[model samples]
Target: MSSDEVTDVIDPRPARRLDVPFQGFVVDMVSDEVDLGEAGGIVRREYVDHPGAVVVVALNEDGDVLLLRQYRHPVGAFLWEAPAGLLDLDGEDPHVAAARELAEEADMNAASWDVLLDLLPTPGGSNEAVRVYLARDLTPVPDDERHTREAEEADMVVVPVPLEEAAALALAGRLHNAATIAGVLAAAIGRASAWETLRPVDSPWEYRKN
Candidate 1:
């Protein structure tokens, strides 16, 4: 095929009705039949219907990134991760969710924010889109105003790792959290480019919208 004819783009997904096989508290196992055009064919696919999420790569004046060591029951390990949360609240903006998670999980706030990266962590098995934000000019949340934690977050420990070191840890396969790895690497790239590639905090995210 000619280079001009080999362009990459998202073909319109075939219309399909989704049926829930198992509905859980926060997600559902959905099944659908998709038309893969003439060359391929129709195929049945099952995946987790996710509500999407946001991650905050909060950076201090020293360029160290805030991280939380939280116990993940599913993974059976404590992971060092950037402050993140699901977009479970009705009508909550992604940016607002990121800010809230930063304060709630990390006990901090950022004065500046920008879109660092967008990702589909498990495209083959889930439609879970994530938006990672670059948060700077950090300040601690007032003790009285701090959010009370529960469950997994109750014993979460806040830690600071330099952005460059975080990126290195990700490269070395030490950072296991998908969002944390992506966020720090993206932040490193953004910093190298003087953040010219960073998007506005309110940048349109069609993946989540759809």
Candidate 2:
């Protein structure tokens, strides 16, 4: 089976990076020297720097999951994804960011939240990480409370699809986007097995803790 089983216990070590000149809500590039005691002492790597992110697996009362279809310029394809966003707000709590993304991207709100899964897209090269939240107890944003969309957030299609169908699309690689693929399948298997609730919303993530 192709899988990444967690086997290393990272020892706390100091890291250093030189800032690159790029202006954006999230870091685009980084120069890093990370200490991996088990693999090697201190190895240098340069890759994209992501502020981490959140994916909202919001389920409506009708048992449908919210999703968005957006045009990705890089991939040159319209990708289906869950409501997600970067941790751009300084000192902002991750759960709050997740809620904000759900409202901004889907024009909806969730009253209940659970830490469904954690994702590290490129642990070997990038420190990017994301938390998937299972959001239930749905509510809609007031007409006057909708967010003004821009850039990638603008002109996207939002729809609700049944959770099982969504999972099948993901497992078949039709979903494509890492966040959507992970979020859909995790939520599906998790719900079937009554998944363990381990990490809290405020759990400290080591990948982005630096």
- Candidate 2: residue 6 Cα off by (Å): 5.2
How does each model score on TM-score?
0.93, 0.84
Clashes of each: 0, 0
What's the lDDT of the predicted structure labeled candidate 1? 0.90
Q: What is the lDDT of residue 178 in candidate 2?
A: 89
After superposition, which runs of candidate 2 have C-alpha atoms over 4 Å from their true positions?
1-8, 12-25, 33-43, 195-199
Give lDDT tens digits, candidate 1, residues 1-210: 788898435566695867888999888899998998898799889999899999999999999999899999898999999999999877789999999999999999899999998998998999898999999999999999999999999999998899999999999999899888989998999999998989999897878833
Candidate 2 lDDT by residue in tens digits, 55-167: 99999998789999998898899998999988876677889999999999999999888888888888866678888898889999999999999998789899999999999
Clashing pairs in 2: none
Could you tell me the C-alpha RMSD of candidate 1 in Å? 2.1
Which 10-residue window in model 2 sums to the lowest lDDT? 1-10
> Model 1, residue 25: what's the lDDT?
87
* Candidate 2: C-alpha lDDT: 0.83
